[model samples]
Target: MDKLRSLTLFLATCEEQSFAAAARVCNTDPSTISKAVSRLEAELGVTLFQRSTRQLKITAAGRHYAQTVRSSILALSSCEDELRQLNDAPRGRLRVNSAVCYGHLYLRPLLKAFCQRYPEITLELSLDDMHVDIIEQDIDVALRTGFVKDSRLVARCLSPMDFVVCASPDYLKQHDMPVSLDDFNGHSWIGFKIKETQQLQPIFLPDADGVYQLCELHRTHITDDGEAMAQLCADGFGFAQLPHFLAKAGLKSGALVSLYPAFRAPMPDSGVFAIYPKRAYLPARVRVFLDFLVTALEAQQETPTHTWAQHWPPHVQFD
Candidate 1:
């Protein structure tokens, strides 16, 4: 029996706690895995697991041994990765998770270009609107809007994403463009849910006796989905506070009119973000992608109104 295979088999068995699972990881049969573990136990003169009819439990010695062996395996893998990158070509399948609209509008093209440039690299993309635990999902990178307050990950700022308070031109013509924050209470509101803050921040600006103020409440329409909210507002249902990136075309084409023009509202956070696990020695692929995005975003800021072009792709980027 190969000693490395036996050691890895023992490690996998310790992690998965089942002969079938360990065998699957090792690309062999459960009997092969069991035989390897038995050989390991024989060589070490110690049983690592105390197995029962219904369950498998690690022995006290096994617990300590597993930690040591796991660390060794990780170190070896890291070394292999370093060697791979040092060869001047980083190659692997990187998993990326992001929200729906941003993935479509922004990340899609950038990712496409990246993959085209590096044919050796592949991407597994997950587009979702809900927040998830990055560690639990085994995600290599995540792109999210606004703030991520969890102390576990590192949040990098990409660009200043502002809001556009808008409603379709027809809707505004029919409904009163209430002149004050208090006036917004009576008007229909389209609420956008902020995952980071866990808050529904709508676009409601009002003048409190000649003084400008922000109205973040009195939501008549609330949805966790942004695309649906935008459609409803575009169809003349109500006012929707949308990201500048998402609302530009509608505003420019006269389909939607920007509301509260005089008083501008702070974005609360950046729309473009590059998030990753907070640890030293970042992966080459992740670093390259992050740098590429930051550069692309800066190029976009110099020409601010490009997002309003009808021909412009949903995610505004240089083609």
Candidate 2:
């Protein structure tokens, strides 16, 4: 008289409406099935079945109990299946998409280590500046910067997107360094044009009240590519506002010098995000890769040379 075995027999009896048929389903004799149900009824102090010579009728209470027990058993079975899937070695082709500069500068370097760690996962990475439909492309995951507007995707913020207004040392030598926002009027500016929209990307700067406001500057040079913009700025084109990922290398190498140290661009919907299609059960390969990427980025943040976001002046630090 195991409780679960009794419940299973009760459910089968309720479904079959006959002890003999239930016995057939349970691969036991009718008398054994009847005894199990009788034991369950005795324990619950409720007559589950209205047994007659010709008909075996289930009571309303028996019907309700059967429904509840069936649901519980199904849930338990689903949990067990999920656990088995998790325990299995993750193996699959993991298709990942990313923005061009981010893929090249940040993600490309980590692929070798990721491949070594998860040898079973076949990694397919595609880099594009324009956002692509992941579902249509069958992409498993995508690394994106700035806001994720699609309601169909789940976006996990990996890091904050910080922008630095900087110029190369050679450019700084030729042009007078601006001490204030007003002084920027006389300085040349390099701008990034959005390839998708064919419009110049707006530059936002924090005001005295720490409110971010869009600032319009005369563009001396413009490019659709972030890396190209960073390069132009580094080669003495002009001062440009560059994302931290694109500017980190130059800043560390002294090829670029940050301007307006106290000012920061706190733009809304600005962050580094790992995006994937919304799903009830995320594949193990995608899940492991996401976990690996997060850990790798955290380790990078701890090291001075490989930190994704730059540490500004102590007074201007923000979480």
Q: Per-prediction RMSD in angstroms?
A: 6.9, 15.6
Please give the lDDT score at residue 162 for candidate 2.
71
- Would you list the clashing residue pairs of candidate 2? none
The C-alpha stretches of model 1 lying farther than 4 A from their native spots are: 1-76, 147-152, 193-199, 202-212, 261-271, 302-319
* Model 1 global lDDT (CA atoms, 0 to 1): 0.69
In order, the Cα lDDT scores of the candidates are: 0.69, 0.78
Residue 140 shift from truth in candidate 2, angstroms: 0.2
The prediction achieving the highest lDDT against the true structure is: 2
In model 2, state the lDDT of residue 77: 45
**Candidate 2: lDDT over CA atoms?**
0.78
Task: For candidate 1, give the lDDT of residue 168.
Answer: 81
TM-score against native, each model: 0.68, 0.68
Question: Lowest lDDT 10-mer window, candidate 2?
Answer: 310-319
Q: Please report, as a residue range, the 10-residue window in candidate 1 with the lowest summed lDDT.
A: 310-319
